[model samples]
Target: MLRLKSLGIVSLICLVAACENSGANYQPVIDGPVGPNYDIDLAQCQSLAARQGAFDSTTGASAGTGALAAGGTTAVLNNKGTNVRDAAIVGAVAGIAAGAVQQQQNKAAIVRNCMRSRGYNVVG
Candidate 1:
């Protein structure tokens, strides 16, 4: 009975080894543009940034004009005019910079969608 049990154990080990050595045939689906999709997303983000910048500039110009009209020369030389305009310009520049950074992130999402549509596995 001991000999029989030993033989059974050896057989089980052999079977497991064989299963481990079995080959699997797998084909991955290739999808989407082979390159980074940053260009398209960057363009979109730039457009958005430009729009925001224009809006900020217009608002700043209007505020500066109002300040000038209100306080005359003092407002023109002091915080009322230049300060508000500078703040608006800075805000516009900061917004554009943020938009550009966001574009990179958005590009990854766009690339993922494109790849999914073509049936490729997106590495998380």
Candidate 2:
């Protein structure tokens, strides 16, 4: 039994050592730019760009309309010699919100591109 135990211990040590050194001599195949086994479609990028453009245009127009309305209200308040600050504040808030939306849309486009580069099908 003692001899068998010694032999088992020796075998375990050899196995551990072999595993440790096995990976040292391994060389990975490196592909540049177009990686191995990765496929990306250019149409995905085009679609993303188009969607982003549409979102920007729509949001921008809405924000402009909102600002115009606020300006009109401010003008009426000024003519009546009442508080016009609130109208200006509301206009600023609406403009900021629209800007934030546009920023988010731009970020989404970047994320879509990244996902496509990572071999994912992005729809939007």
* Among all candidates shown, the one with the greatest TM-score: 2
Worst-scoring 10-residue span by lDDT in model 1: 19-28
Report the C-alpha lDDT of model 1 over 64-104, residue by residue, as the tens digit.
Answer: 44444544544356757555544444444444433433444
Question: How far off is residue 90 in model 2, in Å?
Answer: 0.9
Tell me how many residue pairs clash in candidate 2: 0
The C-alpha RMSD of each candidate to the native structure, in angstroms, is 28.3, 26.0
- Whole-model lDDT for model 1 versus the true structure? 0.42
| Collision count of model 1 | 0
Instruction: Report the number of the highest-lDDT candidate.
Output: 2
